[model samples]
Target: QSIMMGGLIKKGSNNVESKIPLLGDIPGVGWLFKYGKKSNAKTELLVMITPYVIESDDVLAQYIKKFQEKTQGLRQGLGVKGSTAALSGKTDKPVPPGE
Candidate 1:
């Protein structure tokens, strides 16, 4: 069995302002001659996964055996006990080159 984990974090901020020459600096009228905006944002993400390794042919064979055993009942129920080629539109024998 193997384990993997990952994470990411991001944070940012931005400020924007626009104004006319001298009218933007005026006392009360400054609001009409200038526009300003500020913003802040943060984001985070995390991920984890675990997997099993079949290191040898023996191990691989064992997994295959288990899968076949588990699916045998389903196959029997579906009446599909023989080769799957017919269902998949394939032929058991190879075809010759261009007729």
Candidate 2:
């Protein structure tokens, strides 16, 4: 099975400026007396996930073993002596209520 997700983000900004009406029109000093600003932004994100189906417990066990081997190699390459959970910022400790 597979899942697909997509998103779009849009952002905008507007600025209004004021200066001495007549003096701001002067050619050389106009820039120093007058100001205006505007901005526009957009972003897009796409994510896709595919899952494998295990036929039985044996197959699932084999898959787990292979996944562990790959992750172990990755950890070694990154010189991480800690568990994967540490990298993921997860711990087995229970959280207290309202904390």
Candidate 3:
């Protein structure tokens, strides 16, 4: 299990794109694989990344469900593994640029 730098975005924009070293070098889904030399032994890595923390429980729950619904039965993986989400609460204010 590992937690490394993954995605970053601003405000309530559901569409935030980023380019990371090595990751952006690959094409399509191939971008998921960032390294070589996967040993023949058993290994596991469960990444935990909180994309953006918001202030609305309803939105948070909605996004969490979206993540859960998408990652179902994705078994093929390499040295890379991960999932992402936005955590929000009711009291937070939305940024003007993201509006």
lDDT: which candidate is best?
A: 1
Question: What's every prediction's RMSD, in angstroms?
Answer: 14.9, 8.9, 20.2
What lDDT does the true structure give each of the candidates?
A: 0.71, 0.69, 0.49
TM-score rank, highest first? 1, 2, 3
User: Residue 84: error of model 3 in Å?
Assistant: 15
Write one digit per residue (lDDT tens) for candidate 1, span 7-49: 8999999999999989999999888999899999999887766
* Candidate 1, superposed: residue stretches over 4 Å from native: 1-8, 52-99
lDDT of 2 by residue, 1-99 (tens): 779866566666667777779889999888788877766666666687779987997786677667767888988898766443332335576544422
Give per-model TM-scores: 0.39, 0.37, 0.26
Q: What C-alpha lDDT does candidate 2 achieve relative to the native structure?
A: 0.69
Better of 1 and 3 by lDDT: 1
- TM-score of candidate 3 to 2 decimals: 0.26
Worst 10 residues of 1 by lDDT: 81-90
